[model samples]
Target: MGSFQIEGGHRLSGSIQPQGAKNEALQILCAVLLTSEKITINNIPDILDVNKLIRLLTNLGVKVEKTGKGSYTFKSDDLDLDYLHSEQFKIDGSGLRGSIMIVGPLLARFGKGYIPRPGGDKIGRRRLDTHFEGFIKLGAKFRYNKEDRFYGVEAPKDGLKGSYMLLEEASVTGTANIIMAAVLAKGTTTIYNAACEPYLQQLCQMLNSMGAKIGGVGSNLLTIEGVEELKGCEHRILPDMVEIGSWIGLAAMTRSEVTIKNVNWNMLGVIPNTFRKLGITIEQQGDDIHIPAHTNGYEVQSFIDGSIMNISDAPWPGFTPDLLSIMLVVATQARGSVLIHQKMFESRLFFVDKLIDMGAKIILCDPHRATVIGHDFKSTLKATTMSSPDIRAGISLLIAALSAKGTSVIHNIEQIDRGYENIDERLKAIGAKIERIA
Candidate 1:
């Protein structure tokens, strides 16, 4: 276990580039298994989860070559199908949630996919029923080994045939997995209620580049015409929207003037405006976002009817649940009160207890909601020791530590490293006083 020792109340001023999309990189990296030819991917984030997936691919006998910084070429010509059934493979494959995505491409190419129960952040109940249900809907036989705790999907002698599936919910990974599996199936496959986040859009675009027919690229309804095979292609990941939102919160809470560069403004949707409702000034410069230091401090904006402001997460076009924690922390320093509802993940708001211990006024209404009464810069936070629960919450706590008075130490920093790339180094580049201690 490692910890970050941070001296708070420091003003940061500079421009920082957002890391490449973590969620998109996970999907695109797994898609490398779709073809035997070389698939070159650029702008891959150097985070723990991504590196784990790459190592998993290497273990499966895929030829992985490092082209340059944040770039790699993967050729799946010699994939070791036997390795998939090994105990070591199951152990390694269960390390991250993204590892589950490998099942789709593997099932599509080889007609069999095996994975142990995957492990990731303990935010809430993330079910795999959507993925397995989609696979079963596409004419594959699903089997679960209760004793071994493994999931396996196998196709018939003639291989999987396309079939229409309407997802119960717009699950992002489930949609991507089904799309990958359906691309090599026999006929056309239509999916409704598919997740339309930018991550899925980039996956669809990359699949099209690799010779897959997918329509409705940026909407809930997706139609895939199955092709015989997929060829290799080059793909680049966009900036991480969640990280961009965190930086905006960091700038606001620390009274820093920070500009997030090359943010792919078109894809950010309502993220900037959501923060703006907290009375934080967000200026868009072309593709960049400039968050100026609130010299006069910040306030919360109420609705036209003047009710206590509510910031909640929804499907895409809605405020992302991942950013709600940061929004909650930012609200703690604002001029008024706001209600943050994390509808998707129940335990995400549980970290508010740590913030409350730091002297912020927060009422945890329940497992899903938290109402924050802003200190309005009238009171400075008193730093203390804390532990990060998950990736988003870890970064949120880090932002709080950065803005609080005195020194704060955060343990279990590996959670933050799973998502953000070189975060401590990046923050230090912009004048943050944080040190990583082993």
Candidate 2:
């Protein structure tokens, strides 16, 4: 068990480079099982969840070699399809939701795949219905056995054939799974209402680099031209968008002047404008976002039409639901009030009680909405021991501690370690007084 002891009231200063996208890394790592040759993945995040997924891959006899820092070569020339029947495989796959992704490629190559229920941030109801349905559309049979909550999939007609799939939601993992399976299908595959997140974009680009034909790279509609086989190729991951959002919130809350380099600006379309509503000053220098220190804190702004401002998360080109927790904390320091709506995840807004404990005014309307009133920050936040609920909330709590007045202790940091790499070390490098303790 590791914890962080952070002293508040310090401005974090420095130029920091964002790591490879954790979301993308997980998706791409699972995509490796689709091919049998050496597939080089560059800019992979060296984080716990990623390492855990890598361990699972190696356990199945996949050849994995570290090529460089945040880079690796994965060869799936040898994989035990029956590895899923092992108790150890069940344990590892059930520990993370990304494991569900292995089903698509496995079924595509072997015509049969079995996996236990996947796990991830218990933020809300994350469904695998879309994933199963997508596979079904591509000619796969599913057996949902409640006794073990396991999913067993088998293709009836040789294997999955590319077909038009209209998804209910633009699920990132679901889209990735379909794309991987579709690449080896027999005809043109059109995915409607597909998740066009930057991570998915990177996945498509990588698939295209490997000789898979994909059109509409950054849109909700994707056209994948099925090929007999996808050859291996080198692909570099993109910078972490959620990490950039976290750092942006940290700079706003701690009044720090920090520069986030190579942020992939256009990818952050509404994120900047969304934060700007809280009166946070952000400078766009080419691909970097510069946040200046403002001890007084940013001011929360309402809509130009003067309606009570609401920040909600949608599929894409919308405020991401993942960052809603951090935005809630930022709104606490702003001068005005706003309603943070999390439509995608039901339990995501549940973390506001911690902020309320820290002297922020917040009303939890329900599991989906919360009203946050700026505290004016006249009183100092007295640190208390806290536990992390999920990856995003864990980091949000850390940011709250960073803006608090005294020493704060946060436990169960392994949850945080799953996504962010060496967070305490990274904060320390930026002049933050944070120490890790056992």
Candidate 3:
């Protein structure tokens, strides 16, 4: 495992562009399997998980060509069907949770889809029940192999017939997988309680551009009229909202003046306002967000009722659970206290212990909540060694370390690399003293 040795107390000042949406890239890349023609996708993030999925596609004999730095053309005309059922595919497919999305498009085109138990951050129990239930509702037979620990979905002789499904919860990946499968099914499919995040909306728009009939864009209820076949089309992914939020938190923690360029501000629902509530100065300049240096120290804003502020995560248009850790870490330097409630994932708040050890006043109220008493830059954080628990926590720890008084070593950087594209180099561009050591 590699580690990042970061020297603290540097004010980063520059403009940086956020990478392409990792989640959207996963969805778009998997959508390539829905057609046999060449699909050109631009603004693909070159990260570990995305690259792993691309390699998986190549292993299945899809013709992949690199058009530019973050562009690719994928043609699935000669897929190796036998490889999908082999043992090797099971091992390869388990590397990332996003790999599970491949099943939808494959089942839509080939009548069969198989995937091993997916792997990702051990934040909490991520259930695949929603995905299987969606497929089952679409007239596909589902089965699980006890010994092999893999799931398989096979279409009936008549193929998939569209139906209405009200999802139990708005699971992003689950909604995406079902959407991919439903676009090619027979008749019409109505998905209520669908995730309307920008990434899913991008997926629906891309599929529609590829000759699929999907209505109700940017809303919870999606109506997809099943088409006989889908053709490939060109699509460009938007900036990663999670990464943009992380950069905002990083700029505040380091007391830096950094501008995030080319950010699609409209797609970022509550991210900008969430950080603004922490008393960080956010200015919108055209398509960019400028985070001015908080030299006077940031003060957390209280609720209108004079109660302690609460930052919580909900489905869409709410604060994302992925950035809760970043919010907690940023709150450590603010002037007031706030309640950080991580409702979605149980184990995510456990990383607050590491922040507390670095001189931040944080109380781990429970596995799902933490109360942060802002230090307000009165005491500089004392650097220490820590292990990254997950992707968001890793970046949060990096932010904390960058603002600390001494050097800190963060191990398990692979977790960070799985999501962020060239994070160290990007930080270096903004004058951060981070070194990657193997």
Candidate 4:
């Protein structure tokens, strides 16, 4: 496993342009199998997960070419038989929870698909019941092998027809899979409580251009009217909103003056105001966001009872559940006590023990909540080897290392690279000492 050796304590300063959204890229990449015509995607983030998906697509006999640095063109003139069942293919798909997203597109295109249990983060129980349940709504039969823990979905002979179903929750990838499958189904499909994050919206927009009529661009209720066929179209993905949030947290924790460029300002409705409560100063410059270094750390805002406040994670437009870990690290320097709650997953709060070792006064209340007491000693984290748990947790560990004292080595950097694009290269431009070692 590759590792990252990072020396900490120096403030991060520079202008960074976040690459395209990884969540968006993954869902969109699976959409390529929806059509055989040539489809081009620009501004794609060069990340591990996307590269893995590209290789998986190639294994399926899809033509994937790099036209430029961040541009990729995919065309499936002919798909290989028995590709998904190959050992290499199953192993690759099993590594990423996102790969399960391809099940819907594949089932739609080839009428049958096989997927082992997908793996991404160890953040508690991520259920595929939504994915399989969605498949059932599309008139497909599914069977789970208890031994292998794999799922296989196949449409009826006349091809699947759309229907009305309510998702248990707004599982992001689940919504994407159902949307892709319904796009090619024969009739109308209505999905309620669907996750309408920016990434899913982008997928819907891309499919719409390909002649899939999907109603509800950014809402919980989605009605996708299935069409006969879809033609390929070129699309440029929007900048990542999550990275923009991470930059906000990093600037507050490191007290660095940084301007993040090409941000989609309109999409960032509740994020800026939410971060401001913590005393992080954020200014919108057209489509960009500027974060100034604060000598005095952010303020911890409280509830109606005037108690110590915390920033928690939620679905889109609510404080993102993904950034709460990083925010907890930022709160350590602030003069207040707050609780970090992750409503989506149970295991996300497991890394706070490492922070506790670094001199931060934090109480692990349970799997969902952590009471972080700030205004502790201004100390440094001793160099340690840490393994990443998930994409967000991996980046959070990096943030803790960057803010810690001395040097830290992060093993299994592939987890961090799974989402962030050239993170070492980008952080180096600012002033952090981070090197990728084999």
Clashes of each: 0, 1, 0, 1
Global lDDT of each model?
Answer: 0.94, 0.87, 0.94, 0.85
User: What's the C-alpha lDDT at position 377 in model 4?
Assistant: 28
TM-scores for all predictions: 0.99, 0.97, 0.99, 0.96
**Cα lDDT of model 4 by residue, 1-438, tens digit:** 889998877898889998998889999999998998999999999998889888888988999999998899999769984877778877888987788988898888889988888888778988888888998999999998889878899999999898999999888999999999999998899999999898899999999999899999899999988888889999989888878888887777777899999899987767888787777789989888999888766777788899767667777768778778878877777767888888888999898877777677889988999988876325555557787777787887788788778888888888888889999989999888999999
Candidate number that wins on lDDT, 1 or 2: 1
Quick one: how many clashes does candidate 1 have? Answer: 0
Residue-by-residue lDDT tens digits, candidate 2, 1-438: 898888887888998889888899889998888889899999888789999999999998899999779889999997987788888988999998888888888887778788899888888778888888998898888898798878988987666788998999899999999888788888888999999988899899988988889999999999998887878999988888899999999998888899999998877768888898888998999889999987786778878898888989988878888889999988888878999998998898777778788888889998889998886565655566788888999999999999898888888889999999988888888999999999
**Stretches of model 2 off by over 4 angstroms after superposition:** none
Which should have the higher TM-score, number 2 or number 3? Answer: 3
Off by over 4 Å in 3: none
Model 4 weakest 10-residue run by lDDT:
375-384
Model 3, position 282, has a per-residue lDDT of 90
User: What lDDT does model 4 reach?
Assistant: 0.85
Residues 1-438, model 1: lDDT tens digits = 999999999999999999999999999999999999999999999999999999999999989999898999999999989999898898888888999999999999999999999999989898999999999999999999999889999988898898888999888999999999999999989999999999999999999999999999999989999999999999999999999999999999999999999999999999999999999999989999999889788999999998999999998878888899999999999999999999998789889889999999999999998899999998988899999999999999999999999999999999999999999999999999999998
Residue 61, model 2: lDDT of 82
